[model samples]
Target: MRPRLSLPKPHRRGFLTAAAGLLGVSALGGCERFAASPTGRRALKAGEDANMFVQRLLLTPASLAKEFPDSQISPWFKPNGTIDPPDRAYKALAARSFEGFKLRVDGLVERPQDLSLADLRALPARTQTTRHDCVEGWSAIGKWTGVPLAEVLQRAGLKPNARYIVFHCADTMEYAAADENEEAETDKTANPDMEARPEGAENQASDSQAAGSEAPGAEAEEAQGTPIRYYESIDLTDAYHPQTILAYDLNGKALPVSNGAPLRLRVERQLGYKQTKYVMRVEVTEALKGIGEGGGGYWEDRGYEWYAGI
Candidate 1:
């Protein structure tokens, strides 16, 4: 078990109170208006940046979240966010027990690879019992087993400029028109190394469509009606942390669909929202511009802090 990295309970309470007071100053309508203004946006960005900087100082790259023994595992780990993705591709894979599923690793890398559940399992693996702290003020402890993210990143060979890692997942969430346009722009960035889709991409995509799933780029057709696929990003530091893993199992059994089946990110140091689920692709990038509203994550775009360090 790693040492616990946290503030004292009183300090945490004081911080929360100060934060709420700041937020309370702006009434509902005024808050929206202010957040939309240029100055307000800049101020918000500064606050977020400051918070990230301070948190990173405490949550160093090699610092691990406190882990517990098997005896401390929670009886019930409550599921949050999208438990079961409604996408046809996800449903099809789930139906067959993810036999044909493949996790694509691409973008700004020397070698792009597609790995299956078996492939991931065959790699060096880590299992730890860690507590999941949610943004909603809930926590659950569970044992997870998977390959360390660093192992996969090394296998893919990150490019010299690679600065961030993005997790593209199967789950989808709807956004307003403005948000949709922002997402459209994000898909425009080119990955030179991935210009030619990997072989596994074609195979998996075709299989998905054949099984009633929508083809890639179907989101455009849906327009106002379609839901954007979920995604999240983290820096190399977190990516290589010993405890950060691409979890495939929970407790002692296979991860359930309700808890991000086949694969999910277990970034133990951060809050639950950063723990993306149903992950399908790993994209290494040089910058986050035009990616998910330029905020680096699904929830981050909607005002959540990018670094949700405890």
Candidate 2:
């Protein structure tokens, strides 16, 4: 187990300053050198360890980052990751304005939930404007509103073993279709006018038809089927943070489809990807290794760190 260290609230600034100084020195030296040298790695790790210790010590359960007034809202908040869902179900929901969509909350809770958009909207809500810092090095500010995640967890009666909360999404990485045996055999007998469609042309055709149809874009759209929206998991410490919420509204209005309509997770202290959009499920588990690549999140499995505390 990691040791929990505490420092006075007033000293946090100084602690960070000192840690930054150490980091500067460590970075200037080779990271390998720091790792190879027992003393160096210990010192470098000390900065992170100390920060975590201080946060655990000085920050009370009620402590929260400042919430700014609406007048301070950012002018533009770019959508990241999958902007538009390609699944027929998602498109159908989108066509119906998401009225038929429902969010499911299950796993390690006393009561499983199948909540409608209206049900989530009916819950007590919180709204705030916060900056989203992506690992890619861009930032955006947006207003978000949703029920507190703790409230939801409490309502569900979180199991004692639960240590992390996972968000499941409706998007996925696209894959290429494997070559068909029929196509391979037909290559020998195909007429000059009946050449096989190029992958690009096939994709373009699929994009033009509606999902579940023979129309040009239909197959493409349907094939894109509603991917399980991107999923991510965070430790229970952050899950229970006061700022963590299931956001239902953005900018004082119902969330647009482009911004994950109905509901989303807002874990303020982590990187932007940790704030999963188009959330369909929330699962509480003691360990993340059971999910995805056991790294905690989709991006985490793809090289991002799981603990992205700001």
Candidate 3:
């Protein structure tokens, strides 16, 4: 049997405590309100940015996450967030086994371009066995193969002002109005767990209209109080890190829909949530304010830490 890998646990409890204390409440309502309030929002953001600064200042950007040998690979890597994106566009691409899937690279670039899976594969590839740590307190090691994100950023001609790389995904996990976060939904009690979706809620809702198990498509969009866009971002320091990759293969096989087929971001040093799935677009921006809730990530908007640096 393979040993279960885990990050050092000494600080996990302290981190959670400080996070809860910072938000003023452990209950969902208080946490949400505090995170959404202007003063609380600024506090959380400053704390997040400060944490990021400390991580970058203390650790070299190119430092690698510990790598394991092939024998240590997990027998079955648990699919992390938004198993099957049920978006119409995503379905169209998956039908052909992602033969025509194109990753869009835009914003703060001299050239905005879309590259197909073949195009991405043509670039230099790096493979590494790294442990994936989830916020729910679990870890698994898998060998991931992909082109470095820095290579793609270079190809896109990242402008000097590109401060952060935003990952825009296909899941409709939103608490805000469609198109943008202009309006808030009255229902905020659905997900107190901060999971990808409320367990089977999204699956059942989408399956009712979708083609049953044939699609394995998500139900977040159709489900009430679902999460939105499933987005995340990292500053240029982490974005350019050697281990930060756009992975298309996991454990020596083509990535699965449940595991973010076509491509997913793999920032080895951060928590698993920082590595988003069903990545349809990469948008470079000078700031995070325009994205959902302006808190840095989907979970961050709902009270999780933005800088989930582990």
Candidate 4:
């Protein structure tokens, strides 16, 4: 068995809370000031890269994150990000208790697989109670049970060229749709014979359009005025870590919708955002380019550090 690490007590946890708050403020202010300038952004990115390098240098690749006992599990584990995805297709799956839900594992694999929750549950599983440290200065301990990511990766058979793992999720973020509208206008200009559709496409139901179309690695295509879906990525090293899992149960029960019900990532060593919720597709790729802004994660593209090590 792998050696287990232990976390500090409540007093030291308080110290971490204060330190996280200061770091959060500093990071936010720096981004607000420097993100717009090309040189400034590069400098910020350099700092992030350096942080990643130093952490990797100091810690062994397989070093486990600290774990706790059942008694130490927080009474209430707080949820962040999208608790309920606004996508209609996701709602349909959830309504039936995710019977039709299949987690798609594709991209740079010898054998791409579409795995049901039952398929995952049948695999050898790991259970651990660990503290989730959020960048927003809160922490909660919860027991998570799921298959180790390495097991799934091994089953998929990674291509030798694969360098990173990208996680596509169900939740989305709202942003101005001006760019989408502009692209539509440009397409119309090029194809003068194209028939024009009304604004908002008749507010059509997404599930109706996607009925019987549960292809492996398929995500809901963005519609005009629709939100951009959430995505995140990690390196192959972390992906294969013994402690990293695709958690389906939380605190001795099936994970609730409010807590990433169908499946969520438990990358114990990183901050909360890196533990992406509502995970749908796992894409293995050689590079981050063509992924969200080519920054490896939704928040990473928005100037947050991609490594986000705790």
Best by the lDDT measure: 1
Quote the positional error of residue 88 for candidate 1 in Å.
0.7
- Cα deviation of 68 in candidate 2 (Å)? 1.4
- Candidate ranking under TM-score, highest first, comes to 4, 1, 3, 2
Poorest 10 consecutive residues of model 3 by lDDT?
1-10
Query: Which candidate's TM-score is highest?
Result: 4
CA lDDT, candidate 3, residue 241:
82
Determine the backbone clash count of candidate 4: 0
Q: Where in model 3 is the C-alpha error above 4 Å?
A: 1-47, 174-227
Task: Tell me the deviation in Å of residue 283 in model 4.
Answer: 0.6
TM-score between candidate 1 and the true structure: 0.75
Candidate 2 residues 1-310, lDDT tens each?
A: 2212232354666677657757776567576665557765555555645655566576665577567677878665655565455545666776677777888889888889888878877887888788888776877678888998877777777776777789987654343234333221211111112222222321232221412332125565444332223579876677777799999888877775555655778988777778887788888887887677677787666545566766
TM-scores, all models, native as reference: 0.75, 0.70, 0.75, 0.76
Give the whole-model CA lDDT for all candidates, comma-separated.
0.75, 0.65, 0.74, 0.74
**lDDT (Cα, 0-100) at 165 in candidate 1:** 95
**Distance from true position, residue 151, model 2, in Å?**
1.5
Residue 294's lDDT within candidate 1 is 86
Instruction: Give the per-residue lDDT digits (tens) of candidate 1, residues 1-310.
Output: 1222332223554455445544643534577788777856765665565465557656656888999998989777766676556565777788798999999999998889999999999999999999999887778899999999999988998877788899999876653455534543323211101132222232242323422334344565355454477899998878888999999999988887667888999999889889988999999998988887888998888787888877
Off by over 4 Å in 4: 1-32, 175-226
